[model samples]
Target: MKVIKSNGEIEDFRADKLINSLIRSGASIEEAQEITNIIQLKITKPTPTRTIYRLAKNLLKRTNISSSMKYSLKKAMMRLGPSGYPFERFFAKIMQAYGFETEVDIVEEGRCINHEIDVLAFNKNTVVSVECKYHSSAFRASDAKVAMYVYSRFKDLEDKLKKKYHKKRYEGWLVTNTRLTIDAIKFSRCYSFKAMGWRYPEDGGLEKLIEKKKLYPITVLSIKQDSLQKLLKHELVMATDIIRISNEFLENLGLNQRKINQLKKQARALLG
Candidate 1:
């Protein structure tokens, strides 16, 4: 059977890929294989990836709620944006975990004109100017066009950025929630900048980084969407951050004891 990606591309369904994804999301090998079998049986037609995602998530939830939450990471990233602003701040927090001093929504003067940079990250050795390409839908991708445009802006700001930060090295990073086009990756390599997306760069994509840091978002939790929004509004974005907050703080957000308890349980299970 064929599978329809969010971008409308169709390809033959591969059971091994499905199994691997499940295993990566914390499913046991046996569980992943079993789930893949069930998924294959369910694929009677050219299935949309979202349909497969929903089915897989529901099955994983039935098997193990925490694993299901981990599987929800990609979709949860999509939930982080309609506005890219919040995603910029969220990504800055991700960089902080990487030992960088970070700031979001920076307005910097370029050689040509002023520009509002999405994120500015600096360490003792390097200063990175990041353009956050957040998309609400999985259909959108960061292409060569975006890479070119961001690099142009980076070029315009490079001198001022380097002068202000006084770092030994400078980098321009294009960070997006979705996948980057192959051309974009090629463009980045040729330009010596960094490009990161959902599952590029083999060993260390955004998803891998999040898993390594246990930076899973609140959207990955099995909570009401409204409550998710409430948490996001209060900057309670990371599942890993639940360790730092008191129950009283959650109560202040109008979450009841039962929901709070479930939230805590889910967060702990996810961390494991």
Candidate 2:
């Protein structure tokens, strides 16, 4: 059977790939095999990768809640938005957790134009103007056009900054919830712009960075939509934020001790 990848490329589907993914997410050998068997029996035609992911997640949820949660991390990131702003804020928090001072939604004057940066992250030596591209859907990717735009903006800023703010090196970055197109990756590399996405850079992509820093979004938890919205409305985004809050505060949210404990356990497991 053919499988449509997120980038819209069609390829032959391999059941072993599905099994390996499940095993990587902490499913046992037997459970992974069983899930793969079920999926093979059910899937008759070409399927989109997102549909397969959803099916796997559903099966995993029935077998192991923790594994299901783990598998859902990328989807949870996609859920961080009806708009890109929330994801930008979440990205800023992740940057902060990694020791970079960050500012969101800053309008800075470039050499010839004013640019609104999604996130500005800096420390002692490096300053990065970030363009955060968030997509509500998992299948969409940041393409070459995005790369070109961000690169132009970066060049303008770099030109302006060199004449004034000369001490710290300035850079540009494009971060996204989904993957980047091949052209996007090529352009970024050619221009010395850092492009980060769900799986870009292979080793240090957004997912790896989040895992390394133990900075997971609150949406990753298996919570009721109403409760999750309440937390989001209060600007509570991180799993660590939930852990840091007092028991009284959680009680005020109408969560029982049992539910709170479950959340805590899930959050901690995600961090590791």
Candidate 3:
């Protein structure tokens, strides 16, 4: 059967693709297969990709709620938007979770001009100037222009960044919530700087890294808008943060006991 993609492209549907996605979202092989078989039986017409996504999500929820939440990882990343600042902060937290000292939304004095870096990550060996390209639309990607811009800023500040951070090795990096265009990957190869997105770098892409640390964003959980806004307002972005906060802290933020329990339950399921 054929399926309609979100970008309005019609293509043959592959059951294996759906199975793999389910497995990645934390489903066991048995569960993934079961769900895919059901979806295949249901799709007699050329259904939109979003409809398939919803159907899979619903089935996954029935099988495993935690996997259902994880299945929405890409969508949850987009929910951090309307403003890229949240992504910047969330990226910094991801860095910190991996033991890199990070700063977000900082201005650094480059040799030729001042540059605003989205995230500057420092380890014992290297300093990286990171630019985060956040797009609300899943189909949109970071193109060559983004790679060029980040590379230019890196060239201007490489020396200063190294000296200031006391790291001999330095890099200009592009990190996006979406995919990278082919030209963008090509441009990054030309300059030898890192340009990474959702599935880039094969083994260590953004989602892989996040799953490695269980550092999912708070937006991934099933929560009401008001509770989510309050969490964002308090600068608590990581799902694990819900695990760390005191009950009183959550109460002061206007979250009732039931809401608090729900957050903790999902957070533990994701992180533990």
- Can you give the lDDT of residue 199 in candidate 2? 74
State, as a TM-score between 0 and 1, how close model 2 is to the true structure: 0.82
What C-alpha lDDT values do all the predictions have?
0.86, 0.85, 0.89
Instruction: Report the C-alpha lDDT of model 3 over 1-272, residue by residue, as the tens digit.
Output: 88998779999999999999999999999999999899999899999978997999999999798899999998999888767888888999998888899988899999899999999998888888999999988888999898888889999998887788764589888999999999999999988998889989798889998888778998998777777777877778888888899999999989899989988998898777
lDDT of 1 by residue, 80-179 (tens): 7557766787888899999999878879999999988888988889888899999998778899999999999999999988888775588899999998
Q: Could you give candidate 2's per-residue lDDT for residues 1-272 as a string of tens digits? A: 78998778999988888998888666899999999889878888889987987898899989888678767778789778676777888999989988899988999889889999999998888888999999998779999999999999999888776565578888899999998999999999998889999878998899888767667788889888778777776677888878888878888888899988988887776665
TM-score of each: 0.90, 0.82, 0.95
* Candidate 2 backbone overlaps, count: 0
Query: Model 1: runs farther than 4 Å from truth?
Result: 1-12, 40-49
Query: Which scores better on TM-score, 1 or 3?
Result: 3
Model 2, runs deviating above 4 Å = 1-13, 28-52, 62-64, 163-165, 248-262
Cα error, residue 224 of model 2, in Å, equals 3.4
Candidate 2: residue pairs that collide: none
Q: Name the candidate that leads on lDDT.
A: 3
Span of 10 residues, lowest total lDDT, candidate 1: 80-89
